[model samples]
Target: MNFQHKTVIITGAANGIGEAIAYGYAKEGARVVLADIDEEKGKYLEEQLRKGSYEAYFKKTD
Candidate 1:
């Protein structure tokens, strides 16, 4: 399935299942939005995705 131009929002994406889902969507060419309380981890993952040429962003949420 082509995921180009698709968007996926994942909550609690700083670690575990959520984090995995974030990477999965990114690998599929989707723009992933990672929302979590762990800002450090979220930002780190966002940077990693960007470095890998994936579209991703992190948003801090409680």
Candidate 2:
């Protein structure tokens, strides 16, 4: 849908479903906040999203 100026928060985003959802939102032009316990994976995903020109950030939630 239209996520031009929306913000989305996704937990467990280091991999699997949460990661998928984060990318979906990012692809739809939403600012995505990814929360996960795995810092490296979370940061890697954030970097990937950024490289693809999507607004994304990683937050440690555990």
Candidate 3:
């Protein structure tokens, strides 16, 4: 529920379910780490989240 002061690492977070989860955690006040092979989408999502003032970052991974 409340993810305040927490950090969440979500793999495959560039799209689909993982992406949704990443947004969910960020909105719940968690620092969201988005790990995905799709660097473009991941970085885009990270930027969008940041624009909304949510703590989020993207990492390219296999």
Candidate 4:
């Protein structure tokens, strides 16, 4: 549960369970990489996380 300084990669993270998991990791101070085909949603989530001071990035999987 201690994810401090860890790096996590989550696929299909534009929405649903994957997004939840990504945010969970970010909340735990882990670096989160979100991969999905939905670029707009992925970018939006990434921006939201960044604004909240969480380390996160979005990558297109397709």
Candidate 5:
């Protein structure tokens, strides 16, 4: 489905399943918000997604 203009928030998104879901939504044109305590990895993934022209953001949380 077209997720353009949609927003998806994923927890534990610094790696594994959560990261996978984040990419899936982003690829489908959804804006992805990644919530994780791992700031480095979370930020890295956000940058990677942005480089690929996807809308993504990282929020450090417990």
Candidate 6:
């Protein structure tokens, strides 16, 4: 549960279950890498996480 210096790469992270998981990782202090085809949602989530001071990045992936 201690993800102080860990990185979590999650696919389909733009919404639904994956989005929830991404938030979970961020809450646990992990650097979250969101990989998804939905650029808009991914970027939006990225911004939201970053706004909360969590390390988050969004990558467009197919």
User: What is the RMSD, in Å, between candidate 6 and the native fold over all Cα?
Assistant: 0.4
> How do all models score by TM-score?
0.95, 0.96, 0.96, 0.95, 0.97, 0.98
Model 4 per-residue lDDT tens digits across residues 1-62: 88998999999998999999998999888999999999999999999999999999899998
Model 5 scores worst on lDDT over the 10 consecutive residues at: 18-27
Q: Kindly list the per-residue Cα lDDT of model 6 for residues 1-62, writing each as its tens digit.
A: 78999999999999999999999999999999999999999999999999999999999999
lDDT of 1 at 59: 97
**What local lDDT does model 2 show for residue 32?**
98
Model 4 residue 15 lDDT score? 96
lDDT of 5 at 14: 96
Candidate 5 per-residue lDDT, tens place, 1-62, comes to 99999999999999999999999999999999999999999999999999999999999999
Q: What's model 6's overall lDDT?
A: 0.98
> Between the candidate structures 1 and 5, which one is better when assessed by lDDT?
5
Candidate 3 per-residue lDDT, tens place, 1-62, comes to: 89999999999999999989998899899999999999999999999999999999899999
Q: Can you write out model 2's per-residue Cα lDDT over 1-62, one digit (the tens) per residue?
A: 98999999999998999999999999999999999999999999999999999999999998
Q: Which candidate is the best by TM-score?
A: 6
Model 6 per-residue lDDT at 18:
99
In Å, residue 22's CA in model 2 sits off its true spot by 0.7
Return the TM-score for candidate 2, rounded to 2 decimals.
0.96
CA deviation > 4 Å runs, candidate 5: none
Candidate 1 local Cα displacement, residue 19, angstroms: 0.8
**Which 10 consecutive positions of candidate 2 have the poorest summed lDDT?**
2-11
- Pairs that collide in candidate 6 are none
Cα-lDDT of candidate 1:
0.94
Q: Which 10 successive residues of model 3 have the least lDDT summed?
A: 19-28
Ranking by lDDT: 6, 5, 2, 3, 1, 4
